[model samples]
Target: MRVHLFSLSFLAVCSTSVANLLGPVYPAPRDLSSKSSRVAAGWKALTGRLHSETSSGSSLLKNLTFSVGLFSIHDSAAESLQFHYTSSEIQNAPNGTRKVDGDSIYRVASLSKLFTVFAAMRELNSEQWERPLTEVIPAFAEYVKSRANADSVYSTPWDQITPSALAAQISGVARDVLPWDGGDLLLQYAIAILAGLNPVPAAVDPATYGLPPVDLNDALSLSPCLANVSEPCTGPLYAGGAANDAPVYLPWTSPAYSNNGFILLGLALANLTGKSLDEIYKQSIFDPLDMHSSYSAVPGASEFPRSVIAGDFTSGFGYDGGISKSSGGIYSTTNDLAKFGTAILNSTLLPPVTTRRWMKPVSHTADLQYSVGRPWEIYRYKHAESGVVTDLYTKLGDAGNYGSFLVLIPDFDAGFSIIGASALATRSNATSLLADLVTESILPALMEQAASEAKKNFVGKYTSDRLNTSLALDVSPSGNPGLSVTSWVSNGTDLMPLLGILLGNENSRLVPTIVSQGTGQVAFRAYTATQEKSGGLFQRNFDVNDWIVVGSGGYATKSLAEFVFEVDVQGKASRVELPACNVTLHR
Candidate 1:
């Protein structure tokens, strides 16, 4: 049997308008303040603990060998405060130790899965979730077949995996397993084994099976395999290794790394959206929320930076198609990450209902503290004062060897991200320290401020021509926005029957775009092919106080278009116009 691997270079052709038509731009505050001294004190205390745990000696906060940067934001109706910090001693090898800024970039492994989950959710909201994975990614079928046994009981169609399931790691379609090393030939050997061509014993100790030392070349070469092997073959998890027989696939020479499950997800998302993962992310989330410093690829595209966190290697890794690129490929500053946390907690991007679904704890298995949002973990935090335990929605990422930590804390409307490289494993203490600081000093000060401004600013319908989607904004009883496309509609009358088929109980976010606006005749555009160049514009009929399409002459192009409406302010939307191609705006 011949196996054909899809070339990683195959680029998806996505129309630029997919993002533009989805919605308008949503901006976040650029800077934070320090008006609340109490909050600042708390932050100081927390940061002190973080340093105590991670820094070398009690004095001067030195002995830290890795590069580190930290930032926190507190929001409120009255004022907003922000704090920034960077370690002076630690240095990046190639770049040397430099003063890290809020915008400095670092690899944020596994965290990239969040973008994948969001892309999958977008497809679900568009009612395209049921489309076979083969339709979006033909190569996926091959992986599915090689990974699963014919007799395996968990045999659901690959396309049947919902966005929610993928986010929660419940899809059970296992190919990307944990613990990777550089071993190129082992991948080919593994692939051969999965294809039933290699006659190697079903059970062999990976350490004893003539496996080469774990390294990058070996990881890229390992063929895709199911998480489970044949029955009774359980042993220690088989970290990828290399074979010595083939000189062509050398660990040190090859540019590919295999540990990236998320990169595959990026490919899948790009194929499904007809655009690159980076473009989709910028359009769907980054541009809207104004996360300027965040990006999927490394700087300059020529030389990817080394991971600052220790335990992860520097030379054996390359960004091209490695596991780190997809599973944990994001490089961003602490300031940008903090903004992401605020946007999620404040419902600035996704609708309230959808946000709730993302934060909902779907899995409660004891081994797993919480499950719902794609990359986020549901963990419980004990209130320091009350001794009461409360569920906290969080996500964490470690570049493994790089010694970087990315964390998001939704319940507190606060988050912190740290990047550094230490000679010792204990260097991860920097992450713990930052997390502690946010929980203690930063969040409380920011919560009241976030609550006050959020209550007033985010309660209404927002439409965007760029994305061709609409969002209805509303506040939850807990003061968070209940953003979801599942509850959205076109105006108050048009019900989207397709939503029932596409999402059913699954939650989604409504993307929208503006057509045109005027004092008397405000018009809006929806989803339509003809109006691709000119986002559909609607003008208000002065006499009826209702919105009406500004005629073809009135529009830059007289083409039929589709439009969506957000009703009930749920942050979800339904297609409202197809034939009419226009909508009336009302305050």
Candidate 2:
């Protein structure tokens, strides 16, 4: 079945009314030469500036034994900056001062999703997004068998979901509720109830699913939740007890992780080019870019550091770790990560066209936008002097009690990463501090330098036929110029600094025109139950509505229309109406 996925298009126009209202605005960023020099002087100067305002910030995290590292490499030729950081000291702090350098490996939590993204992209590059799960992952069939057991309540086929959907978290597969909460164990307890091993109250309805009668106090007394909880999937019950119940079953096991998403991409890539993810990364990325420390899997973990990392959830970091690894699992140092970023900016890893496609935002949810190449989060930042809007494209990870974060400003060729222990006390605050430091201080400085260097080459209006958007570009006071795009029909409002890497040419002009020969038609289908209707002329109990267009010009007045459809209980369309339509005529 083919789903009608939405696409956005733009129209070109010079509106006098808009121009008069907004006025002729020049694109200018802040003047950052002095600021950049001050910040680059030393960590003392930068951190001192940060310390003056918020004593409660990283200072509070000082005693927590958290390790914070920052590395920034600026490529003057490419006008980009790359950086990363990691610290095992957060995990084994104080007494066990294992200084985390370039090689220290910590559980990267959801940061592993980066690996998944790369793997998926590799597959896409190799022509493998549409392949079957079983073909890509042999162990996936076993998961299907396990979930399809006679007593199992889940009846959905594993193959019904796609790798991309799983990576994007749109598969509709309900995540397992960890037992830390007061909810009943849905899987194991349900199984026990079905097996008659657990007794139900005589007055209770057998069909009504209720929380397992297992007392939390008793369970806690039996075994603590933190002990031996190697694989998260095994113990669907999040409460205490059975922490060491070897072979726990979290909703997404290792096989399920690979099968559900990550491995599918790996398999797709392998099938497309007859090369494993390891080989592909080595050839296409690592070798070419000299990212020597980067690897698909962590080093010294097993015979094949890569293969060992792909073991069952029991042997790995449980569901969270497994899922992220499949998607974002990549081990690299700050230096190597910087190299990777530079490679991307310089189009060393992939061609410029492919790089732009990778960075193009892919819709995950209404609120969140991601792309094949990067993960992004909407964040609000406050600096001493100014507050600016920053769409921080970053990937975050948390493995067991370890975590890491990597953020990139593609437009500026600037980015930073923070890796540390996953312990609760320091994880959130520390990561936030690191990110703030980068965004408020480090990245701004980097962007200023890049802007200053590339000032001459980056002045012009850039229009997109695909997005039906046009950006008026000019240099900023800081060096990087501001790009302002007036509102189009599709995008509701004017966009400032239309933040995206410029694809195609600076001199290219895009004009939006209507296709006059064709008439556009959109249909709504409804289902109904009525009397036993047989043939093509059968009658239905419910009423059906059909919308038809007799002429082309009648519907061609506007360039964009937002329509709403109403359906009846019988699944038949009651009515279809165009609520609002906006058309912009190109000048």
Candidate 3:
């Protein structure tokens, strides 16, 4: 919602007025193909260049396995595209003999968090979001009770952490605890062997010989995973390991990444749903979206035909994240990732309001351009043409040789996904560059097309039968951010001046809220441009009101600036309802 009441602007701030537009000048709503072709060509060129350089054995990303694809909620008419490159070395591997394509699967490391949060959103209610982790998981509750009454560096206050906190990376727990590599012990063995000494010592008690001392957090002690070469920690060892984690920051003090936080959340979800995390994801997300190639656990031998083997084919290619799967272990293809992104963007499984609430930032970082959602890394993209900020909900995964990125642009009901694998440090850079290229080359065109489409359908003169009381709206032909109100009259009196305090020199625009108002009706919230005179000397909000008063006037709705437009079959508005003014104007 907009902090400032929606206002209007003139030609000085945006593109030319509607008089020069309204024809074949701008891209039609469904005519988004030319840009897509150019974007596809750009991606193909990048990968093709890398492949050529790799064949010559001179490229920095010589072994990089890369793929990217665009998706849309409206896919039937959408000109979606995919591009990929795989080395012949990989194609000849045992399990990777199959060529890479839309169905080819790679480990989507941290992107699994998106599925975890989606499961939580589907199974848990609003009240459960704030419920403490201690209250949900008995093992974790026991561990917290084992800690002394004081909060210190040795122990985290898990009782104060909630699913919301964990999902938002604000739980204040240690980032990770399992896979505590035992390199020192191996080094000692190496030194003993070099000196012609026996590296193998006589066996001691089985309970005390091979693992760390049996302490509160020695859950890994029951298993050999501390070698960091085994399957992920699960069961008591997983719970105990997480319980022993130290405090990194107090809850909500800062945004800190915590894999164990997600691990704990998986345990809590299992406790609440009476199902394993694997089952939960499969039933709630994967199966429902028809994501045939997606899996929370390792695929069986039959599924190996589609797996992308990056390295250490025996163990690493099909590594099971086990309890930590919710954090960084799942596998998917461009095809499946596209379906998943579409489901979230369209609210296919969840209600529109729930999706809206889920999409918002739970906490913001120090970086102005970045924010955090439940599992979303939101990047604020400002269209240079209209100066409107669009939040691109994204999730990026990086674990060992595997990397993935899922980006959703709600404004255009469009998004894209990228997944790649490489031992080189450049793997992350390659995926990031894919996102930047698409946003730079295609997003501006999409946004401009949206403005033009809205102008053709919604902008016009509307008046009541009472005469002299009318509304006129026009969008900038070049690129206004939203539908600008050129005129508004009520009961023979001009009310734009009355709302000037919130409107601010006529600079607000109506942007879609996606708030459903029955069929053929759409909702829009008002946003007025406000600036500060601090000259970058201070950190502050430029809004005109406090957060406390938000929605208190309309009880969860923007009362002052909400406009409901009754549209027809072709999406042209016939009338607009101004609830704040208790008036309806007809066209």
For candidate 3, lDDT tens digit of each residue in 119-204? Answer: 99998887888898778876678977777575666777878888989899888987766452223344344334456665344332
After superposition, which runs of candidate 1 have C-alpha atoms over 4 Å from their true positions? 1-37, 50-55, 58-89, 119-126, 130-135, 140-149, 153-160, 175-221, 224-261, 301-318, 322-324, 367-372, 403-411, 437-587
Q: Which wins on TM-score, candidate 1 or candidate 3? A: 3
Positional deviation of residue 250's Cα in model 2 after best superposition, in angstroms: 21
Q: Model 2 over residues 1-587: C-alpha lDDT tens digits?
A: 00111121111112111000010111112222233443253334555654453345445344222223443233232212222222333324332224444444444555655655554564463324544444445444455655555322333344554455445444333332233211333334434555686464433433455534544245343333333456453212321122112221222321122222343344444555676556767776667777666666555434222111211334342333322234445666555655655565445546666766656444433222222223333232211121222344566664434456666554443455665553445455555555555455564554444444323333344434444544333343331123222322324344332212121112211111111112322221111111223333234212111112111122246211222223232122223333222321222
lDDT of 3: 0.68
Residue 428 local lDDT, model 2:
55
State model 1's lDDT: 0.42
**Candidate-wise lDDT, in order:** 0.42, 0.38, 0.68
> Which runs of model 3 end up more than 4 angstroms from their true locations?
1-63, 92-94, 126-128, 180-232, 463-471, 477-480, 486-508, 525-528, 531-563, 578-587
**TM-score for each model:** 0.52, 0.49, 0.77
